[model samples]
Target chain A: MKTGIVVFPGTWSDRDCAHALLEVLGEPVRFVDYRERDLGDLNLVILPGGFSYGDYLRCGAIARFTPVMNAVADFANRGGLVLGICNGFQILQEARLLPGALLRNASCEFRCEWVQLRVEQSDCAFTVDCRPGQVLRIPISHGEGNFFADPHTLESLEANGQIVFRYCTADGRITPEANPNGSLRNIAGVANARGNVLGLMPHPERACEPLLGGDDGLAIFRSAIHALNRVAV
Target chain B: MTYRAEVFVTLKPVVNDPAGLTIRGGLHALGFESVKDVRAGKYLSILLDEADEDQARSRVEEMARQLLANEVIEDFRIELQPEPALAESRGGGPS
Candidate 1:
């Protein structure tokens, strides 16, 4: 599987993601700068975390207009697997590749710590390795990770099972106390309708190794390879 | 003629505004009991190079739609302000 990670002007997690993919996941990943106009060659495109363009004018607004986004959008359109993490999630939403918007955290504080996430849908290519109802420990570091959607859109997302993950307790119980950002319905992640594009506010890349505290995030990277295999077969 | 436009962008009623709520709490703590609420939003001033007011308004409206405001959770309003005359000097004759 050919994998590539996008690097925006203010992106800081690209190297971390690269390390996880190369050393941990054993995937030969390449860096695609924000100025690149061709994403038609990759199987999986990862948008890593950070304050893109200094998060100015809005977190992802400026980056949405970058030449790279247009290619990413086109790649997603033709069924390429796209995974957006943290600020990457914000950019995906701003680019309109994913529905809903991420707002300021309800507590108005930048939270950086480990959190529990329940797998809501394991049918998508991005979460295919995770079992539905399984809880994974991940770290989230952001001040604006609140996920919000209009009533109709929210309802449709639920009905269509587009929600792929939710912030929850260690025991997999959904509660307001476990919601780090006060996202609607405790949603922490979502997959586009076709299930190829996934966006989540938590940094699974940060937890890909046991030395980092836990390797629960390994399943996501495993799922990426599995997705490619499924397509290849 | 250059036209000045002020744009106000705020979250929709159904969307939660955490920043605004925090500001409200700060105001209440400052002994301002009369302050019932605070809703924070973005304010931007755009200087237009177009000669016609209608044309400038339309262009700014497009800008707001495409970038200045997110249609999903926010609404935007635009107001045209009078252009500052270049002929006027600062402080107008030094008080």
Candidate 2:
């Protein structure tokens, strides 16, 4: 898989994502600065997490207006694969590429720790390798990861199976105590209606290596590879 | 002619009121026992680009919709006063 990581000024996870793709997944990965407007050569685009623009005004508010977002949106509109993590999720919301918005955590604090995410849907390229109800241990670090939408939208997401990941306890039970950000329905990730675009609060790249605690995240990247390989064949 | 607009945006009532709760607690400690609820919101005083009262009102309302407020979770109200009176009230010499 040829993956491109969008580098906003404060993107701290681009290197981690790139390294994970190259070193762990053995795929070609490149850094695409926010100024780069072309998406011609990339098979998958990853919007890594970070405190973009220092989270001023609102998280992802400033970063959403970047030049590259237009290209990214165009690419996604053309059925390209896109993955957004953490602040990247915020950007996706701000760009209106995804439904709902991210608000400040109910605790009103930055949460950073390993979290269990249950795969609710496996049809998405990013989760094709995952099984329904399967749980993956990943890291989530953010202050405004609380996902919110209107009741109608939430119902639609649930009905359409676009709700892909949810916060779960170690034993795989979904509860408020297990939801780190107080998101409605304990939603930690979601894909677009078409399932080509995905945005999640968890950092799968951070957990790709076994030394980092678990290899649960490796499957997410390998899933992308599997997707590309299938497309090529 | 000039117009002054006061715009207020506040969260919808159904939304959680954590900030308001904290303020109510502070007020109770300060002996303001009659204060049952206090919702915190933003207050903005904008100098209008137009002077006609109706025109200015519409313009400010448009601004509120486009930027000052998120229609999803908040609502805004606009009030317009003559800029000359606003300046006088501010203790500034007539313009």
Candidate 3:
């Protein structure tokens, strides 16, 4: 399966994503510029972590208007797998490909630390490799990662099993203290209702190597590859 | 006609405003104990050409809805004013 890693002007994590996908996982991947209007045939598209467009006028707000986003939106509508990490998640929400908005952390500080994530839904494309309630150690580096949604939307997400991951303790217990950001319901990641688009704040690419702290994030990518291979066969 | 739109965007009442809260805390530290709450937001000034005041208002509203404000967690208000002097100064130059 092939993957496309989108690179915006201020994006800093594209190379990390490429390293994880190409050098670490041995998957074919390419860098897609934000100015490009077409996304070539690819099984997965990744919006890596970074301050796209300098994170001005709200994180991912301006970046959503880039030419590449139109193609990404169309690709998602056609059921192509899209994984948005950090700012990518914000961009997806801003583009309305996903629900809710990311607000500033309650502490009003930029937090960069390893946090535990409890996999809430294993049936989705992004977490198919993770067992239900599995805990993964992934680091989140951002100031605006507080996820917020209205009551009705939150209920729908829960009912539809769209919540893929939540902040939790090392032992896989969900608690307020475990939540690095003040995300509602400790939501660290979510998928669209169709399950094809996944957006999360954690840097999975940054955690794919054992030398980089851990490899638990590899499951997220491996899961996407697994899902893509299933459809190809 | 040229119109200037001053748009104010703020978080919804239910959404937590961390920046606002921090500001309130700072106020308390400054001995303003009676400060109940504070809500921070963004202000934008946009200049556009339209046929009439109604058209200008509608266009700026559309702009706020489409880009300036995210309805999911924020609300926006726009104030429109005609800029006749600026329009005259342009003297029918390129928009």
Candidate 4:
């Protein structure tokens, strides 16, 4: 798969995603600058984490207007696989590529720690390799990861099965305490209505190497590659 | 003509405003017992050059809707008035 990672000003996780893709998954990667207007035939594009545009005005708010994001929107409209991580998730929401806005954590504090995620559905390209109801160890780091949506939007998302991950315990129990940022319905990640784009708050890129911690995140990347191959076939 | 606009972007009351909550807590600790609540919002003062005050009002409303405030979680109120003749003569709007 031709994979690209977008590098935005003030975005800190772009390198992390690149290293995970190249060193861990061995998926040769390209770096697309925020100023570029063309994505250039990339099959998979990622918006990595950190405070893009310094989280001014709102998280991911200012970065959404960058030149590259317009192209990213077009890429998703064409069914190109897009993955948004952490602040990237916020950007997707601001760009209207995803529904819902991420707000300040209910605790009003920045949280950075390991979390357990229950695989809600394995149907989307981002989660095709995950087992239904399986739990994976990942880490979340954010202050504004709380996800909120109106009742109508939430209901439709549930009905369409767009939710991909939820905060949960080690044994796969979804509880309030498991929810790190008070996200609605404990949502940690969700896919777009078309199922071609996904936005998640956790840092899977940071967990792909055992040297860092665990390798469960590698499966998420591997799953994307497998899904891409399936599409090629 | 120059027009002055006062725009406010406020969070929907139903939405949880974590920062506001923290500020409220601080107020309570400081013994401000009568404080009912504290909600954070954005305030913007914009000066516009338009044909008339009505045109400026409509233009600022669109600007607030599209960029100054997020329509999903926030509501914006715009108050517009023509700049005073003296201020207009000085090439400025009400600050």
In what order do the candidates fall by lDDT, top score first? Answer: 3, 1, 4, 2
Clashing pairs in 4: none
**Local accuracy of candidate 1 as per-residue lDDT tens digits, A1-233:** 88989999999999999988899988889999999999756899999999999998798999999999999999999989999999999999999999999999999999999999999999999888988999999999999999999989999999999999999999999999999998999999999999999999989889999999998888888898898898899
Residue-by-residue lDDT tens digits, candidate 3, B1-95: 88898999999999999999999999999999999999999999998999999999999999888888999999999899988788877777555
DockQ of each candidate's interface versus the true one?
0.82, 0.27, 0.82, 0.62
Candidate 4 off by > 4 Å: B83-86, B90-95
Error of 2 at A85 (Å): 0.7
Q: After superposition, how far is residue A204 of candidate 2 from its true place, in Å?
A: 1.2
Clashing pairs in 3: none
lDDT of each: 0.91, 0.86, 0.94, 0.90
True contacts kept of each: 0.89, 0.00, 0.84, 0.42
Higher lDDT: candidate 1 or 3? 3
Q: Candidate 4 lDDT, tens digit per residue, A1-233?
A: 88999998899998999899998778889999999999997999999999888987778888889999999999999999999999999999988899988888999999999999998889989888988998989999999999988889999999999999999999999999999999999999999999989999999998997888887887678888999999999
Better of 3 and 4 by DockQ: 3
lDDT tens digits, residues A28-93, model 3? 999999999999888899998899989888899999999999999999999999999999999999
Deviation of model 2 at A96, angstroms: 1.1
3 or 4, greater by TM-score? 3
RMSD of each: 2.8, 3.5, 2.3, 2.3
Give the TM-score, chain B only, in order for the candidates: 0.85, 0.82, 0.89, 0.86
TM-score (all chains, Cα) for each model: 0.96, 0.86, 0.97, 0.95
The CAPRI classification for model 4 reads as medium
How do the residues B1-95 of candidate 4 rate in per-residue lDDT, one tens digit apiece? 87889998898887889888889999999999789899988899998789877788889988887678876678889988877874557675555
